[model samples]
Target: MRLRGRKGIREDLEQQQDLVVLNPEAYKGKWRERFNNDYPIHVEFGMGKGRFISQMSVKNQQVNYIGFDMYDELVRRAAEKTRIAWNEAELGDPTTIQLALANIENIEDIFAPGEIERVYLNFSDPWPKKKHGRRRLTHPRFLEKYCRLLNTQGQIHFKTDSETLFEFSINSFADYGLQMTNISLNLHRDGINEEHVMTEYESKFMGKGMRIHRCEVLVGQDALQEYQKSRLDKY
Candidate 1:
């Protein structure tokens, strides 16, 4: 999707800088302190319009949620959605949701080791070319970064509409030695409809009769080490 420049996008983002971490580099290892709570930090990478993260934060006040996207315009829109959601939900503290403009390729620079409890990859780019396999969010390189950022029991919850990407991600996770569970080829058809926050892409795709694939993988130190060794062996 080509992103057209939005008017006043810069100014809009500046106005919500308090709610969005414009300088994520400064918070790097101290994200928990920024939230002013030890509540488990959950992040949604590629949080396009922010519907899922905003709703998730509103519903689960105990968890601190951060939504990351590469575009300022997208982050600004997400911040607005979060603010509106907080007001409608009548939450006392709206600090539960934090938006950030950062590229996923450098996620390590934004988060510290063991700082995040969970990570969500919702409708991420497939990077469908074989030559672009390494660029996929579920690729071994990206998974390595996620592993370092996640705590002992941290898990990745991934949802996608692309079957090819889903299958590739499953193999990637297995190759990295991550333990997978709650695997569903067609999420909505699996009789697990409750508590599922629908994202814009998810709603559109599912409404068009496209099945959404979902999976959860637990990160472990052993898996990380094995993945690292495999990478070394490729040299």
Candidate 2:
């Protein structure tokens, strides 16, 4: 799916404000206002093409979903997929879902502390080299950022196909003292596909007979309290 983008894709995407958010930072702490609802907000980092988040948003109208990516091309694809999904279901308004073009490195700048209810990392870049460990999305620094944005009962779900990356993430989460649950070494084999949403990359790996590893880490009250103490906390 990584190829040259179609011409004028950025312009087309920008015009779809209902699907692709603009100046996301402006609505940082007021995400619920942007959605025009009080529903909890959940986000997916590195949301390649929109399969998971779009479907989740359509299925779970009670929660607001946001997908973020650095590439304008990918964001365009995500918005198109969301529009198609909404249209297929005879839905006119897409107030529950939004796709944004932004890098996760400065995620904290886009959302205020305690504004997010859930954080999802699906098939994220492994950054395999030891020297690049900090660059991984599950790194402590990034985890801290997630914690800051997550509520006391916030959750972080991670999925990956690389055993090396999975192992690294397990250790990283443990070192951060985060509590993990419902871990799946082989998600599809565990008969849990019904509860999971497969991304485009995940489907490709599955088609190749690759196993997907998944885990969930909860941000305990203590962690959230600590984050709040250090931040200009927002709801």
Candidate 3:
């Protein structure tokens, strides 16, 4: 399903002139100076509709946020929100957010080594077909790319309603030697954990009485090596 834009979303981004890089190669090894901040970096992949990333940026202004999504329309909306947040942040306003239009699979080309501090995979496509399992966002192939860009202490946060996908991701993390922390099979049953922020999808699902599955995976060089070695034939 496609989403339509409200008035001013596109125009807002144009007015702000925020740096929204579409080409992955253009950002290779150059993101640090772009935002003019050396603070820790966090990313949200498939930032559908921009709600989660924008809200997180407002909550944590110290961490620079770079959201990646392939959909041009969605990216534009996200860029608008980021620009708004950035402006507010500059004017002593809270929340600083940035965005990029790129695929998660090209993450290594999108950010340099040791550049990323954290990653959030919020309600990604489950890719239910067995034959298409490799395309799953949490598949080992993509995890390898994440590992390459994330710093040694970087961590990945994932939330989804698809039980199968969550199980698959859990196994992938274990296979790659990533330590899993704070896993919740039913996030809402116990109330939203303070650390568990709601994405657009997460909020919608919870409203419909569906439970959210969440987990965190620590990323490091060793995990990256194992992920790459295991996914060689698949990728």
Candidate 4:
């Protein structure tokens, strides 16, 4: 886990947001004002380096996107890509996409009640140890956080190459009473689905002949309560 010299990369990230801190706490319930749009806000938790979100934002100008990643170095790299997009006139506008350094577990602090429209959990870290199961992005605890942030009928689109995490997520979704839709075991076999955005990790993993697992779970008030109850039982 020894990462080489990347301090300059982190410094680059700091430079990108020199004028403002993209901490979620500062913007918390004011997402609408931040983007100056009433459109639904979709977020990608653990945006590796922002490749996926940047490309998606450029392709779809109507949807507002917020990418939250914990690593400062990673956020900086992603922010650099975003800066490039903003500079290019032919790339359309991505003023809707905001990058933030924040923990995914703190969704309440990052988003107001029912403010998020969709969540993309792409190639998230799979805490393999059984004791670390709760830390998994698809765990009930994390799912509850996402459920609370999402608007009624909001959806979570998840893509991962890990079968263990995918199974864990599917069970969590069904157990929590969320409607699971469009479950796919192999993404590339489906003829390059437009809805499926590829992350940096996804590109590398899929290149090695891996099967990408994906699913969409719809969130509602009723589902939120059920998710909360299930998470409570775990404690």
Candidate 5:
């Protein structure tokens, strides 16, 4: 996870106003308005290099997508890839896809409650250590935040190559009272679904004879409330 310095990456991203939202906070609750459409907003957290989001936005034009990453260089590269895809598809409007540089811990600052319809966690950092368990994206704290940000019946799709992390995520989702489905232990070896958009990590791992794990979690009003109650009880 060592990031190489990219010269002028920030300046370049700032210039791509149509692709990267430099001031994401300005459109916090009004993300759909920025797209000029009421399409459901889907976000991919930790969208490294942006390969999956770019392809998904092109394939599903009806759903608006926002890719969030902590690094400006990675976000810039994602914007570049998305722009190329849009151009190849001959789509004049690039509003369907947007990139943002932000930390997942402060996600609430960038998105309002119930503003997002779906979340995608692709190959996220596992933070694999007993002391770092809380840092895992699927931890109860993060799941609670996701519940607040998602609309009723919102869904989260997570894919990973780490079996330990995958197991932990499954348990995390269950502990948070989120409903889970579409579980797969070996995504590619079992079968590649039509809706599956191969991520950069997925491709690389599969090439190395590694199996990918995938699952979908649904959050309802009751689930959110239950998670909140559990947090309150802990205090």
Candidate 6:
């Protein structure tokens, strides 16, 4: 859910070079250098207003987090959230969090192969139209990109309120031959724990009595080879 543009959003985002990255592609494989440490890196795709990634960054101070969103307006809001968290922050160097603006289509271009440790897909756009299946984040095409971007131990954590999309993704991952584990049909049934961080969409859905589905897909070199050998474009 993208927000309507507010006045001065672009200017404010431009001024947030410390916390927001507009030219993210330039960093590419050099993200570790940007963070100035060897901490493992995790990224949240489509981070709406940055609730999940911001909290995760502070909670897991040992890991670096990058939140990517297509909207400058949302990026600005996420940066604002990070700033507030920085003030009240006790554990981590809030600098460990960097929000960026990027589209999912060219995501492979923004990072070099074997650069990311984990990728989070939280409440991503469903792109439910049959013709737009390629646009779904869980599509085999994007999964291929993530496979190249992640190290051998890299994994993707995904959550959604759309059962249709969730089932589609399950089939997609299975057909792609990528190993999936920790599948959850109703994630909050046990209630969110210290390790669980809710996104803006997830919080709203909870208020409306909606169920959240989640799953984890592991990335491996062997799986990458298998995915490259076959095609599931029909998905």
Report the lDDT tens digits of candidate 4 across residue range 1-235.
2234375765565665532145679787898788888877888888877888887887688988888887776677787777676667475445778888887777787678788889999988888899999989899888888877788748899999999999999999989877876799997984666776688888888789889999878787555566667779999
For candidate 5, the per-residue lDDT at 200 reads 90
Error of 3 at 224 (Å): 14
Best model number under lDDT: 5
Name the 10 consecutive residues with the lowest summed lDDT in model 1.
Answer: 220-229
Segments in model 5 whose C-alpha atoms lie over 4 Å from true places: 221-235
Model 1 TM-score on a 0 to 1 scale: 0.91
Q: Lowest-scoring 10 consecutive residues by lDDT in candidate 2?
A: 226-235
| lDDT (10s digit) by residue, model 3, range 37-74 | 78788889899878789878877768888778877678
lDDT string, candidate 2, 52-166, tens digits: 9988987887999999998888888888788888888887768799898888987888999999989999999998899999999999999999988998769899999999999
By TM-score, the better pick of 4 and 5 is 5
- The residue pairs in collision within model 5 are none
Q: Candidate 5 local accuracy as lDDT?
A: 0.89
- What are the clashing pairs of model 3? none
Error of 5 at 183 (Å): 0.6
Q: TM-score, each model? A: 0.91, 0.91, 0.82, 0.85, 0.91, 0.90
Overall local distance difference test of candidate 3: 0.78
User: How should the candidates be ordered by lDDT, best one leading?
Assistant: 5, 1, 6, 2, 4, 3
Q: What tens-digit string does per-residue lDDT give for candidate 6 at 84-124?
A: 77677754446788999999778777899988889999999
Q: What is the lDDT, from 0 to 100, of the residue 235 in candidate 1? A: 100
Screening candidate 1 with a backbone cut-off below 3 angstroms (N, C-alpha, C), the clashing residue pairs are none
